[model samples]
Structures are given as C-alpha cells and as structure tokens.
Target: MTGIDPAVRHLTRTAAQMRKKKPMRIMLLAHSYWPEHSPPQRRWTTLIREFRKAGWDIDVVTPVAHFPQGRRRLPRSEAGTPFRGQRGPFGERIKRVPYLRHSGNRHAARLVDQVFSAAMSIPTALMWRKADVVIATAPSLPILVAGYLVARLRGVPLVVEMRDAWPDLARDARLVKGQVKSVVERVVEAIQRRADLVVTVTDGFAQTLRARGVKNVVTVTNGLDLEAVQLLEAPPAERDKLEVLYLGNHGESQRLDVIVKASALVGGDLMHLHMVGHGTRRPDLLKLAGALNAPVTFHPPLYGADLIARYRSADTCVVSLRDDWKSFETTIPSKTYEVLAIGRHMTAIVRGEAARIVTEAGGGDVVAWKPEAVAELWAELARDRGRLTAGLSGRDWVKANADFRQLAVQYMGHLSDLVVAGRSRP
Candidate 1:
C-alpha cells in the first residue's frame, strides 16, 4: 500500500469487494462456441476470459463443433457431448446441443442445421442454472429466436447482439423479400423490439436501429486481445515482389473476385495476393484466378502463431467489402482491427464507417471498387515501398477504440445496469 499508486490500491480494494459479492451469472446463446474458429466464438472467448477475472459466471449454450465444414471433427470432450455441460478452458460452462450434419458450403443445408441446433438450444438454455441476463449472438439467426424465448421464459433481460447489419444485410442480399416487408425482416425487428437490449458491433448500425425506434441499442464493436497481439515486424526490405494478404472470409460481401481480377491485371510477375480462409465463394474465386492466371494463392485458414507469421509476411493487408451494398456502409470487418493492431499498411476496399476508420488510422489508402483501380494502387504501392509501412496510427486507433479489455469493461457496465434495472421492474 505504501509504495503502490493510489489508483492501483483503490482498484485492488474494489476487486476484493467484488469478489465477496455473489457472482452475476450470464447465460449466452450462440451457434458457435470455444474451439470453433467463428467470429462470435472469438469475440466471446476474450470477453468471457475478462468476465471470469472479474468473478462473473457464464453458461454458454451452443451446438457441437461444426463450422465451415458443417460436421463435427473434434472428439466429444473438446466439442462437448449433446445434453452434457462441460467446463470451458476459460472459466465458463458450455452446454452442447445436437447439430444437423451438412456440407459447409450448402446454403439450404446450413439453414436447416442452424434451425435444428437453435431449437435444441432453447431447451438446453431453459434447463441451465438461473442467470441474471441472457445474451443471444447472431451469425446464426435462429439462435436469436432461441435466446429471446429462453430469456422470456426464465424472466431475465435479453441482450441480442446483431454482429452484422442484419435485416438490412438480409434485404441487401435478398435473403427474403416480399411485396411490402418480408417475414424475415418482421421477425428480426420484432425480436429487436422485445429484447431488453440490442448490441450492435458498429455505432452506425446502432444509430440505424435507434432511428427505426428500437430504443435500447448499444455498440460493442469487434475488438482484439491487445495484450496478446504483438506489433508485427516489418516486411523484408529486399523482397522480390510485394505481397498483399487478405485473411478472412472469401465470401461475396468481400467481392474477392475484384481482388483476384486486380491481381491478374497487375500480372503475376509483378506482385502476389494470398487469400487465407474458407467461404462459399472461395472455389469460384479459385476458378477465376486459374482462368486468368492470376498471382493469387488461396490457402486454408491459419491460426495462432501461423496467422501472425502470415501477417509478418505481408507488406500490405486488405480489408474489403463490396462497395455496391448500402448495408456495408456500417460494416467493419473484424480483421480490420486486427490488421491495424499488428501495424500493417491496408488496401481498404470499403466505404463509410470502415473506410473512415482506415482513413483516420492513417494505416493505408482506400481504393475504388474497380479491378483497374486496385491494380493501379498496387502498382503505386510497389513502386513506393515506403507507403506500405504506415506507422502506429492504426495501432493507436485500436488502443483507443477496439481493445477488448476496455470493451469488456464497458460491456460489463451495460450488463450490470440492465440486471439491476430488470430486477426492479414489475
């Protein structure tokens, strides 16, 4: 106490007091969980770790390990057996639900799998130990339904996390369309209205929801475990050809076709593009690249040290979304934050909020969504190698905005306030 800073001492005392209280319990509903390399899993894994340090209890209801490939690959112990609750490597408890076996890339099959698992999740969550709040994270939409039902029956505040700009994205993609308003849109908005809180990953989406009169929306954007992500070493000075890397989904929203075409337009001898991940559009992108003889390599996903090594190998990283879609105006790719944190130059093929963040960070330049434009930018970047080493501006932005430690604390406040207010209601 004598040598410690007063703030540190105060915090230590507060932490001790917090430990003495009954831990606030949370039941989270999701289509993915730990050991699965999905976006929701990554976001929640870091948050749950922080929650545990603060002495909170979390119970996760999820389907078995089946993502990208759409069938279980891990042993039951790691994936968790259906109807059995297993302790997570982090401090939370995970209750598994059965999933439908399907091909990873089949749309109808994936939808069926999501529906089956979501239905099973409702019962799994309802039978769990009591919780103060129930959180439903969407990437799998039916999980939102299960979350709402479970919260209502259990009589707790429901927090629906719309990770993407949903209903809007659905409309943009035309997943559902009617003469007036589709049933999908109605169902999503209804759930948003009924939920005690709506958590959006981007402030733009939060504002959008509020404009539509859903009053309880809050933005908790995707973030990094900064303490764990190192500032990557710069690319080699004597490189033969500049390498631009895109690591994440190879899906339509990315319009990766443009990227492949741009790489071909540059000619394989000048530069190379490495796209690492699985998605519905990956095979098509491969075919296009082959047809054009593009200098693009599509690799399966890399994680942990391998992912960092991939980042280290790149002179520039790409954070792209199709510019034609209005819903994307609010979408920020999770990897954008990662690229910024790791201190890489970017080719941000995005607009609105995502482009603004990149521009503000001074990490890189945003190019037009054209093959010739992208190819021209790459040529310019290649000619001026110095442009590829944007300094700590991006990292600084992440520290100020997207660090998970800070985000988790902000989220805890929201959960605590809701839990208190919820109990006080009639």
Candidate 2:
C-alpha cells in the first residue's frame, strides 16, 4: 500500500480521534445570528458550520433577526417557527428568543433593547441541557453575563469573544461619559473576569484586556472565509473612470463623512464614490452627500454573490476611521480582509494598527483623514491606476495568513483544551 499524503493522513487521524471522543456539546450565546447580515452573525455562522463538520453538537441562542435595520418576519416550516428551534446547516440547532427591536441610530434605545434581550437569553440558554461548553460573543456585552451564569450553573467553561472592546468603543465614540463610562467599564471587566477563555479579534484588543486584568486572552483576528468569497479575474487596470467603493457598516466609528467631504473636494468627472451597506449613519451620510453635491452613490446592502460582484467592479476599496477615536486605532475592520481576498487595492483613511496592517501588507495606500490629502491621493491613483491594481500580492498574503479554515482548526483545538481543563476543575 502506498503511503497516504501527510495532510490527508493527519486529517484522517484527527477525524477518527474526534469520533472516538465524547461529542462536545457547545452552546453559543450572541445577540445576533445567521440571517442577520451583520459581521458577528456571519463570523459565528462560519465558525458554527466548521464546528459541526468537526463533530461537535452546536446550539446557538440568539435574538430574533433584527439589527442595523429592524426585524423582518422570516418564513417558518411545518415543524416549528424559527423562534422556537430552527435547524441550521449541518444539523446545528438555533434557538431564537424574544427581544425589543430598537432603532440603530439611537444608542441609548439600542442599549436598552440589548440588555433586555440578554436577560431573555439566559433562560433560553439554560434550556440547552446537553451543552458541555458555552461561548458568548460581545458587541453586546450583556450576553456575556448570560454565558457566565449558564457556565457556572452547568459547571462548564465560558469562552468570551470580544469582537470590539465594548464600553471603550462606546466611550471613544462619546456614547458614554463620566460616571456612565466608569460604570460601563466596571461591568465589562467583571464579565471578562468570569470567562475561562477570553478571545479577542485584534491583538490590540487582547493587550487592552490584559491591561485591564482579564486573564487567558487570545487574539484570533477576523479573516476571510475563502470558501464564501469567489475571487473573479481582475479587470483591466485602465477604465473610463475610477470607481471608489466603501462597503460594510457605516456606523459611528467609520467616519464616512470624511469620504463624502473628500468626494466633494475632489469634484471632477474622473472618479465617483460608492457607499454600500445599511447602518445608523446611512441617512446622515446620504444627506451630507446631497448637501455637498458630491459624485457619490449610495446603494442598499447586498449579500453573497451580489456583494462579491460589487467588490469585483470596484477600482479601489476605501476604508475610513474617525481619527479622533482612540479605540478605533485597535479595530482592523473585517472589510480589510474581504477586500484583500477579492484582490482589490485599498485606500484607508486610518491610523495606528489598521494603518500599520494596510501599509505592511502592501495592500494599498494609507492616507490621512484630511480631504485635501485624500483628494491628492485619489488624483494620483486616477493618473497611474497600476498603483491601485497591484493587489494580487496582497491577495496572496491574505491566503497565506488569514485563511478561515486554518483559523477554525486552531480555534477548535483551543476549545477542546478548555473543555478538558473545565472537566478537571472542582
């Protein structure tokens, strides 16, 4: 018999070992889940699919589909409504709980709804009697409390995944202040202390958590799900006019107003700016674009293949940040990875860690937030489009470093170790 390929052999052994061991029952607590096109939902959906394939029993407890935009009723099956129990892909189960749908633009109103939803999720999570481990993801930090209580009650490990630094981001955005900021910080820290594993999406976030005395922190940066994004053949470097695109959340941190101001400052027939995706700031941005008479088009959000096509059509992908916000320095937008995966050049109006990544990766130019600076860069790129077309190398870099399959494998190993450790504890 010929020897098997090393990779195949390793996979075979791993599969057999997984089958031999008791199947891990994992409960995921998030305020959002699949069918909501938000980043947290998409990230966890991909992770849950991989976990199910790896022979784990996955149960997701989330609020009904309502985010960025308000809730829409989805079709239900004869078996039951999705709110009761929905069978997700690969036999993974999802349980949607009740929550008030608040408008995204009002921060205080949104927080109230999230806190109420988080409280409702605790009882729903307790219903999953088979769960051996629990993971709580936070853009909504209240869910971490639910996960902590569930884990404590069931004698299982609680894994807290920080997609953003929560109250820090809120404070930086001026959504929280003074005593409110201190109280929020205390609550977030207390939740962090309860977790057996603290997973952060950025190294900067992990460092911040460590400084705040959180233990067992690990950085698992957001990456491209290579399987989902079908990279198309690169269009010619030469085009009739430049098309600059900014896709993904248009929230407070994005500072998309800078992009609009830049478009107005650089008013010419040579280039047009496109902003896609729905968020609290979309209406304000639309109004700004109109007031400035900028050559900017706003498109409603697209998903799956339609979103990929939009990326493929772009001459350059623009990423923006509010320069005044210190917390934003730590956020490496997931869109960065997506743009690189689609082999598109990036122009980032950012600083600190995000700028460092764009610069070091050779993905594209990192410009200051000033309209004059951005206009100048756009003019240069319009003249020599090759500067914006040199993204094949960036694509290669992403494939090598940020493939989701590899990250999923590493994540599973981490979770398995946590399970073993939890089992041994008194």
Among these predicted structures, which one has the highest lDDT? 1
Q: How close to the true structure is residue 338 of candidate 1, measured as C-alpha lDDT?
A: 90
Instruction: Put down candidate 2 lDDT per residue, 1-426, tens digits, no spaces.
Output: 158755446655665565566668899998887776778877877777777777889998887777765554554441223359888766888887777766677778788878888888888888766587899999887888888888888878889998987768877777778897888788878888878999988888889889988879888778867767766666567887778999977888888888888888878477899898877888899999999999999999887778777887888899888788888878888888877777788888888888888877788899998888998898888888878765467667666667676566667778888899877877
lDDT of 1 at 358: 92
Which digits, one per residue and each the tens of the lDDT, describe model 1 over residues 1-426? Answer: 699856446546655655565679999998998899989888999999988988999999999888879988988789889999799978699999999998888777998999999999988888778899999998678889999999999988999999999889988876655754477788889999999999999999999999999999889889998879999876766677879999998887898999899999998777999999999998899899999999998889999889988999999998889988899999999999999999999999999899999999897999999999999999888878878887788888888889887788778878887888877888
Task: Give the number of colliding residue pairs in candidate 1.
Answer: 0
Clashing pairs in 1: none
For residue 169, model 2's alpha carbon misses the true position, in angstroms, by 0.9
Candidate no. 2 TM-score? 0.93
What C-alpha lDDT values do all the predictions have?
A: 0.88, 0.80
After TM-score superposition, what is the CA distance of residue 111 in candidate 1 from its true location, in Å?
A: 0.9
Candidate 2 has an lDDT of 0.80
In Å, residue 235's CA in model 1 sits off its true spot by 1.7
